[model samples]
Target: MRLSIIRDAFDLVTKTQNLSSSKTDEVIDQIGLEIEIALGKMHNTEPGVDCKDVLNELMRNLLRIAPLSQMEGIQNELNVPLCEYKKILEKYFNPDISKAYRNFDIDTHTLNQIISKHFYREGLFDVGDHFVSVLGEPESAAIMKSPFLEMYQMLEAMKDRNLEPALNWAATNSDKLAQSKSDIVLKLHSMQFLKILQNGSIVETIDYGRTYLSPFTSTHKDHIQMLMACLMWIGKLDQSPYKALLLPSNWERLAEELKRQFCNLLGESYNSPLSVTLAAGVQVLPTILKFTNILVKKRQSMNHLPVPIDLGCEFQFHPIFVCPVSKYPATEDNPPMFAACGDVFCKQSILMMTRNGTRVFQCPYCPLDIDAAECRQLHF
Candidate 1:
């Protein structure tokens, strides 16, 4: 059904010539043409009109087709063109105009005039008048693209206490929004727009900014604007105390622990007891020391440090040192020595000397020699 209508609308748009002036008459004539095309496409050669299907098609065409024309053409002619009035009664009340009129004692001519005035003027005042008349006053008002119009309608409707039907109708057509075509005057009247900037959903901020913040307008910095909007949205939310604790110390600690656990899982000692391989011995100490420094600095920077100064800077944060490997001597009296190429080894190059040995030792990271004396433990 949608495809059929789209094809018809395309044909209509293609065949029809552009209105040079877009005068009141031309606009009205275009509306008549649209109605004719919709009727023809929904044309039934059988017993009667498929009233339900025809009505649905007509409303969809209005919602989709009409918006395209308004978007493409100049806005001045987008006013409810005159001929649109002829079909309003047909479109709105459906096949049961008598039933509708009887139900409410509403005058059809007055309604036609109201719709005509709105279609021609395309102003908030006229739109409000038409909406109030058609939907009838229990102020369920939402400005289609115009917050000011919505607010005005809402205010006008509020004067009358009976507003349920209007509210219900407004809610029903909530999705029938036009990208608000507002001038400076309309903007001046938009209070809800300001309120939403102060407090609204993330989705709403993006949507509103598309219209209000012109793409052509240059900002001092793109990132600054983006971050500012994010900050505004974040600042408005109900924050928790724990959200502030995400610091460098916490991050570094997490990384160190993860590395330690991973090495343990790989069957490697996190803190090597036997300096059997240079790689195994090198892995744990430097990483732990670096992380300790990071945590201490971060804690001090955050002003969370107390007594027992470690770094000895103005910030008195003490670092917790990891214990040295158990098998290694505590004193530098028998410290492990490395060769000239920055390879840590003791006494000799084991890999070069061994041939029939079940186990041999070497550097894991680079081509460094290892001590043979510690390699024959063979347990690991």
Candidate 2:
């Protein structure tokens, strides 16, 4: 429920933003076109189309469109949704984020490196360079600059709807990408194929496909088939069932995929490590804030959370098998064992109860009894 409210508020703000931009651009374009036509007539080299008459007509059309009023109306259209969105935000998550803050041992050098590196990761080379020059080390920036620069260049070209740079980069790294089990190269070509086909150039699309896409046929036959299916809908592809291929997000997903694979090739993470840390911290802040007082008191004694922190599967790096019976995490010496009723407990806990397989033991959480031999050591 909390997430839904936030999502709806966010969507309202975005919707208003898109509408505002569209309406403003549309009004400006219409006004500009009117001025261009009026100017051409006012400087009438053609016969007797009165300059005064053209000026009057222009004024009438301008008045009809009412650019200023149109803009004011668009602003009014935005006010309610935006005001509601702001209210929703303040109502839901008004936490003092400072409450979750904790001091770290990071010194000047490491902090500079992180700040400078984050700038470069976002493609702000000049800012990053300046930042490093002041109090940071420029060498740290240089280490990642080359690779990230190329990635930023591809991203820029992608923004302009030019895929050649990204396609070329993907082609060059085809071997590495394939070795890493990345299908990004195929994806790049697929987008390019649709782009060419959408422009009503069948010969080029087929030629490009035959040259660049045929190789992926054996491994990605289904995807290739889906692309080929679009040939029948060519120029009218947007009206076809496969129209989703043309969404703006496809390019975004491709760009992110390219970034991920590029970083994978360079043995780096796609997200800046600092960004990852901050994101994790944000997700955990609420839980920590709830137990702030207790945590502060036992800070030295506690090695883990007072209660389990379910960070979901994405943040979980490894399998955790803490035995419920013993209330301790599993280890090599005391591995988790599954009994007949599918209940798991530490090996030592079972041993103490069954006396090293001399007798049957009942499952801790269920009524089922089992011999020690029936229990199997659980692997992560």
RMSD (CA, angstroms), candidate 2: 13.5
In model 1, the runs with Cα more than 4 Å from the true position are 1-190, 215-380
Instruction: At residue 200, give the lDDT of candidate 1.
Output: 50
User: What does candidate 1's lDDT look like per residue over 1-380, in tens digits?
Assistant: 53465455444443342442444355566667778876776665356767677668767766564565654554433333423433443433234222111133778755554443343223345655565567664243332224334333443453442334334433343333112221222222122233344465656755655554443236324532543344354444335232322233533443344334323433434443322234442333333343445665777332222232233342222433211222222233333434333444322233344546734455544685554555431110
Candidate 1 CA-lDDT value: 0.40
Best by lDDT: 2
Candidate 2: tens digits of C-alpha lDDT, residues 1-380: 77898898889888998989998888788889999999987776477666888889988998888657777889998888889888887765556767556676768777767777788888899988888778646666678577789999999999998999998898898889878999998888899899999999999999999998899899899999999999999889999999999999999999899888988998877788778778888787767765664666767433445566677776765798877776678899999988878788899999888975476987767788888888899888
lDDT (0-100) at residue 117 of candidate 1?
34
Query: Which run of 10 residues does model 2 get worst, by summed lDDT?
Result: 300-309
Q: Positional deviation of 5 in candidate 2, in angstroms?
A: 9.9
RMSD of each: 33.5, 13.5
Go through the candidates in order and give the clash count of each.
6, 0
